[model samples]
Target chain A: MDSVNPSSKYKDTLSLIIFIVVVLTAPLWGKFIGAGYPDLLQKFAIFGLFAIGYNILFGLTGYLSFGHAVFLGIGSYTAAWSFKLLTMNPVPAVIFAVLLSGIFAAAIGYVSLKRTGIYFAILTLAFAQMGYNLAYSVLTPITNGETGLRVLRDDPRVLDNALGVQIDGSPVGNFFGIEMTGYSGYYFCAIMLILGFYLAMRVFRSPFGMKLIAIKSNQTRMEYTGYNPRPYLLAAFVISGMYAGLAGALMVIVDPLAGAERMQWTASGEVVLMTILGGVGTLIGPLIGAVVIKYFENIFSAINESGLHATFSFLPEWLENIAVTIVSPFVGDGWHMTLGVLFMIVIIFMPGGIMEAIRRLTAWVKRMRG
Target chain B: MEDNYVLEISGVNKTFGGLKALSDINLKVKQGTTHAIIGPNGAGKSTLLNTCIAKLVPDSGSIMFAGQDLTDGMTPHGINQLGVSRVFQTPEIFPELSLLNNVMIPALAKRDGAFKFDLFKWLRNENQLQDEAMHYLDDLGLADSSDIRAGSLSRGDKRRLEMAMCLIQHPKLLLLDEPTAGMARHDTNRTIELLKKIKEGGMTKIIIEHDMHVVFSLADHISVLAQGAIIAEGKPDDIKGHPKVREAYLGTAEL
Candidate 1:
């Protein structure tokens, strides 16, 4: 209905193609920035999917959930247990993760959605905290407690054992005998991210997406306009949860571990930061946000005193020392501080997130060319 | 007898704590007629509209719209799906969306019912709905700025956009709550014109108005409320000269 300009649909297709190309070739370009490693690249793909899913709920419906990490944790746990009991095939694990987490989201969303605005946020947060604590203690038998749930040799991989498959090494995620590790793992996650991005794009362009945006803009108006906002909101919540679940499933697929720490409030907050930083409501914004944050966590945090010194080695001895001291806290273990500052800058200046900045830049460039 | 009326409120009573917001109120709006509810501030005119839309529940009464009871635990959206569309006192448009999208949303709601998981159905594919929305926008004189965000429009434009939003739904009944609340005389007349145009479609309309200009021009019948109860009910001419109605407004001053 918003297709006033005829070429907008064409633009969307072009954007999707560009997004696919960029994501698929991440490792190639990632090498340029010292992020070529499969583990870190896989993190990019996985978290990108997570943030994209989170955007569907928060960015679309404006129901800022503070507990999506619980879904992620649930997915991880489900997939890990699937490996232990059902099979090592990544397909079933992914399916179970998505289904279980969607159910959890439906239950939690039904309750949490009863209240809107800040109350909704607090309710979701409380439910997530309850989930985290339960997993850490009361649900220890299922979750495997502090050690986290891991695929074990002694456990029955029903399908694998049924096929007379032997245990190879430390019980990694095997997809039809092909190891889901290294570059293969990154590609698998990348493929998922691409598919997820496409689905999100479809949602964004669909009438359902318009309804979600309408709910976000004015939920009261939406209700009066002859639409039930509750179901739409719950649907968005469940869809987003499934996305987080898929992300979690991918996490354990690459690493084969489900930890209680993944469900923490901080992890939930991190996705929020990613969505806001990338540009809420825009399709690729969340992915950009996810990659930036993950990149900071993996690469920026690894910058030690020596690395800083090496970068500033051209400066005089005293100047280099001063520079190192000034920047040290923002790098390495204090990387989150740098992230906080970046978040502030994005919120203060580019409230629409990095996507807004890019839009502004392009508009300015067009004006200059004119 | 009940089949003759499009909307019937029988002995509806609503109280906000100790304040009797509405008491023993009964209104019957006939099919294909414009019924106006006029009252001084705090007379529960809006509250009545709220009840009609299921936004507010009458403490003890039945609001029957087209043979269905609105008070029987029906949600606002469900009542809307029953062909009841309203323009609120202050225009309730989706501010962040384009005017076109704002209009299309209600149309989608009407066509798709209250809830449909049409997630994959692209909006671009709904060419017919888009054309209809554009037609309504053009009717309301908002087509020129249809691409602009609804929030950026002037108050009068926003009101008109909200009208287009409702008009696109082609609802069986339309409720206008002070559709010209804070508009200039120029814009007010324009809104009156738009309301009159929609009236040709013979949709049953219940309008709550303070402006007698709007009331006289659009209303076929009128109900006057004073202190949460109807003081007069008749044709427009009868309501215009009713002593109780004049006193309700001018407070004992003979006109």
Candidate 2:
């Protein structure tokens, strides 16, 4: 393990500048583009936050937690409840969601961190399943059972009532003189994503983060160094869980519905795919991966075989039929299968994910230049 | 000599099911001196180091460090916080981390306590830790490779880097397991010279070694173990002449 040098400092600064520029322009691009695209972008941003958070633990510490969706689900459920019961203000809802998720993560992490490697992952998966079951069966009144929780129109916003006008079904809550919907909602999620990204970047550079890498490399050596691996693992797990919570809260803010499916194992698996696809341990890779996967899910899933056939009409009839037949399995209902194949290809051929491939290409180019 | 005895072990016994790995091992390590523990295979040299560092709990024994009773089931982190650090037989550096971050980790752990939740703070701005890491890396001739990933280093360089990592904590006691086990003769000599420099810098070290050259060149005190029991303990020259030590080595020729 080495420390940051002056040269890498310049690279870091340049990357940060590029990141800021892209973030600043994302909303502008979103506003000008198709409405559905912006929504997809928002989903991408939220899931990116989720995946980045997951990577902090899984990527850094080498703990492959299988129950991370519990945190996200908890965040969504808590945020929805806060909005429906306490207030409609998104800030409080997000804060409540994060706090609740953090507490949940801490408790689960405490028990799970007692085990290492596969056992720790199993513990997390079991806890997540427990949470999922609870949300479906026992927590029916709060979670609203299979139908899930929705923000009712009659939910009282005391702050709005104090102003003497009933603001029912209106997305017009002024938070410090700013609307909390539309552009405001997007900005809110984007800001949170940025903050989460920044925090993760800091952790990547920190000494504690180095300890995590060491623990990942060799647990026995870490023990001999006088460091207990459990606490560090637990802390990473909680931090990652909290990030998932924030993502869940953002999910509800973008669309105020908390479904039981949000906490499902598949949801957890999706984030794992995103992290691995993007490049685990690389700061920007998860976000890019999240965008790519969500883009395919939303856009590719909508394109039917007929639609593809019509689009490719310029080709010869028989060739177009063959192309459509070949491509049909990759679109619509087969999108997940396509993703699975893509994941396998990337894993086998480009084990470091897209970022590493790009890094290697750039290094190769530099060598050629030399 | 009173303050110099940083590590005191007595009646330390470790058993795995029906077999005893270590029995009644008593030892004292003086500050800034290199104390070497040598034994043939299965002599429990690794087990003793593990017990001292709290990786494995001794069944019945006491380990005292700097006036603190560390044998009361403290965690490895707890013992590390008490100013003790160890290096493995193989290089255990973080393969992905830069060399500087590796050294900085233990240094920060030593300075900032075992665990910290400074989530919102930037760690690189902690000038004190950066300075200390740099100082240690410079001492071990690894400052030039501070930015390189530790796994990319040559074997000799990796060993030096690991040493730098252990030293950065300014530990009162350092435990090294086979510091020259897999090195070439030149690399072993380099490691010996590094150990000599470390000792000259007033760092107390306990080394578990098989290479007699490294042991003889660096150890001020030597302890010989045979079949999990210490058979000889004295100055290096005295242990070298012990018939029991010779017999133990001769009996374990297959090792």
Candidate 3:
């Protein structure tokens, strides 16, 4: 009918390859050069999945949610219950996590999407806060309050008992016979992260995804064009919520506990920080954001005065002391200060986040080479 | 009555806090003709268009389009489904998307109703809709800019892309709200030529325009509105020298 245009499938394939290579080598990166990665690396993959999910809703659709953590919490709680009631197998837990979280998200998104902009954000936040409070106080029978719902030795795990309790000391989440703990746990999460990224990529390129982004760009335009975005938005909300739940289940599979603290408003805010900090709309940006924040939080904060001294030992004593004094605030108990400064600097200089900064840097280097 | 007229507005009244944006306005566009509503500023041309498109509900009136009573809380989406496509005055579009994407969305909306889960469906699988959208884009002379971001287009091009988006639906009734506003002469002429080409297709057109040149050249019938009411209604030649129409335009004394 009309004319022609170029396509972008090849670029997507290349990016997918790069993503797989980098994530598959997570255990071999820098300080993680040992046989088994510290639990922190698992945190990277887990929260990375969560942030990717959040990006689908907020970044792709422009639905800024202040309560996505509730999906993760619901997932965590559901996984814990599955372990205690039905089985200790990670498969059942992951499936249940996604299913229950999706149902809950649908119910909440239906109500929240009635209003848009700040009001939508507030509605989701209120729903999440209510869920958190219930888990902390009212729903203690199910959530088990602050200590959270954990599997005990006496839990009537029907599936496990039916198969006969062959393992020692309570139960461990397993896939067939392989335990989901230590190195295996990291491996499990890494695989899930890769799969999640692939699915997210598909969504980004799909017609449905285009509709969501259209709604984000101009809802009024979309309406006049004969597209009602409500059902599509609700679907995206549920899908992303399922991703959060999957991450939650993975967390429990790795650590075997779900706490009320996991559902707090701060937790929701943390995922928001990760999504925006990496790059609001870029595919790989949320993962990078998750890594940066987790690295600062779990690893950098552990750097003590002696650790700082070792790093700056080559300097003269006066300069070394000064370096330690300055660096110390950015590490240990004051780690959040480093993050705060980073957030401010990134917002001021690169409002598009780290991904934009990286893009510019690469372009500059390319120019220099030319 | 149903066979002759495509849009019928009866007893429509809309008041914005005593401003009386539109009051008791009644108009009918015969099937397959280009009808223009020409009015001075503040004469409620835009307001009446908004009410017809369901962007604003008339305080009291019935909008009947394609045998559907559209006055009962019908949404814009609902109105659009009845084969009514509106070209806004300001050229509203999905600015962040590619020109191809901007066109494809309307095609898909026509094929897939208001919403479809369609989450896993590959973009490549939408070959039919894509081809249709490309046809419209090419028709509008925007095939070369198909891959460019819609927001990056010039004002004229953006308006053209918006028309391509609306045209894909093959709407039975097209409501254009000042389609040639703020355009260079070349673009305005190009638009008029495009409209002339579309006129052959026999879709009823309702154009609310301030540009008398466009109104006289393209419109088969013209209605002159002022102070929230139609001051004159006749063929373009008849309306040109109508006494009340001249009075409204030049604010001449009754004598």
Candidate 4:
């Protein structure tokens, strides 16, 4: 029961250095090899933010939320509405999205946190489905129905008007002189992703975070020690929701559309899958999973059956077609089948996820070096 | 009636369905004394201890600690904040977290209220918190095993670590549920010595024990329970010689 020594300060500094390197170099790599697929990389970074936030609740608290996509959808819809009605400035729109998501999360968390384990997961899923149904039918007027909402050239921007600029098609009206497209948009999300990572790291190291772990470990003991665990659990849920909101806002900023599909339970399940694939609870694991999954979805899906056959033409014709047929289901719309198989394998063989496997490998290497 | 009496339980009754787990259990322990509750099997010793600490609510009872009516509605976190801590019969340390972190939890909660949302604050840089935790671990002779997982500890070591966790909170009342329930004789002796040292160091403790030798050696006041009622209460010698106590325990053997 001795005091644990502080983890090496250099460990954090080193991680920061590595993060900076990756953020700076990734877009450049995308530019060189992705063949006009910078959007793919940007989308990966945005979803990486979402997955990281989702992991805060799922990985750390040992609570699996199946409706996290509702927060993401709410954030996107709120930001879209803000841009359409109030202002076209991305700053306030993003802030409003995050705040709205926080309020939404608080409401869901307060109700859902009364139950634990599978019940809690079902409650969250039920809420998310309710949100999805509302967006699709009940709230069609505000949410613009299944067709979603869009910003037009005539949309009023009071701030832009007050600043003596034209309301429509003006180059001077960019967000702090950086256009919300291409590299600038990618950088904006990349910066926010780093900040989100920093905040999550802080929570991981905080006493409140430890209390969440305590609740996860022995909730009965936590109660006996005089803690009402509901508040802590709710707080974690809300913070995670805000993270989802930021990612959602970034999505609308990059492409000014918010659809009901974003709120679907499948999106929620995708984030969970990403987190588990990369390593739930590890700092960079979810981000890695997000990038990997999005990369497959965006780039790998473009490789159709004919594309596979063209690449494998050096082999015998029968062998080439057989190889193409064998791999066809995993290339295009069937990519999800491959993802499902990969997830099952990971769950069975590496239950701790890829991050844990990496950690074990690193420990073994260190032992050998020593 | 002493000002420093750490715990005061009056008219505490607990009924589980049709059975009375505890009934009208009134007890008080002065500061810096080792109070022991002993009883035959099913005597409600554990239930009484649980009720005092708000683990189980009594149907019609009040528990006062440090001059406050810490009755049925207060939670365990609420009681811990009022300077009361408990060690369970089974080792309840965080199995995955290192022993150091397990002890740090209660210590942190004691220092930083019942709840704080300081998600960005660094726990390691909290110098005062680390110092206090280290002091308790040093006293418990667990300084060497601080980084090891608490679940991996020997039974005797886990008990010591659990005690250390409770002690670090600087509780006014320490409730131990069978501190030596499943230990070897040597380990039991060591636990008795630890309790003795804790009492000498000015911490009030209430121990629920079945071991008569340990009870007689340490208790300043003894309460014997039988079938959910306090059948005898006195000095250890008086309870040992009481005819009813013999009948409850020895069952026809002459004392």
| Runs in model 2 lying further than 4 Å from the true structure | A1-14, A27-36, A168-184, A312-326, B1-4, B17-19, B200-202, B250-255
Total colliding residue pairs, candidate 2 = 11
Off by over 4 Å in 3: A1-7, A30-38, A305-327, B250-255
lDDT per residue, candidate 2, A167-190, as tens digits? Answer: 445443334446556666667777
Highest lDDT: give the candidate number: 1
Each model's lDDT:
0.90, 0.81, 0.87, 0.82
User: How well is each residue in B148-202 modelled by candidate 4, as lDDT tens digits?
Assistant: 7777988777887888888888788888888887778887887788778877889
Model 1 misplaced stretches (Cα beyond 4 Å): A1-7, A309-325, B250-255
Poorest 10 consecutive residues by lDDT, candidate 1 chain A:
A1-10
Native contact fraction, candidates in order: 0.88, 0.45, 0.80, 0.66
Interface RMSD measured for model 1 = 1.7
Candidate 4 lDDT at A66 equals 94
lDDT string for model 3 (A1-370, tens) is: 0011233668678888988888877777735533235498789999999999999899888999999999999999999999999888899999999999999999999999999999999999999999999998889999999888888878888998899856578577888888888778888898999999998888877888888889999999999999888988898899989999999999999888999888888889988989889998778888889988987787767888899999999999999999999899888988888888989898899988899888899899999999
lDDT tens digits by residue: candidate 1, A1-370: 2122222678888888898898889889989998989999999999999999999999999999999999999999999989999787888999999999999999999999999999999999999999999999999999998999988888888888889888777888888887899988898898889899989988888889989988989989988888888899999999999999999999999999999999999999999999999999988889999998998888779999999999999999999999999999998889999999999999999999888989899899999999
Comparing 1 and 4 on DockQ, the stronger one = 1
lDDT of 1 by residue, B47-141 (tens): 98998888888889998887789998999898989999999889999988898889899999989898999988878889899899999999887
| Clash list (residue pairs), candidate 1 | none
DockQ of 1: 0.72
Error of 2 at A28 (Å): 4.7
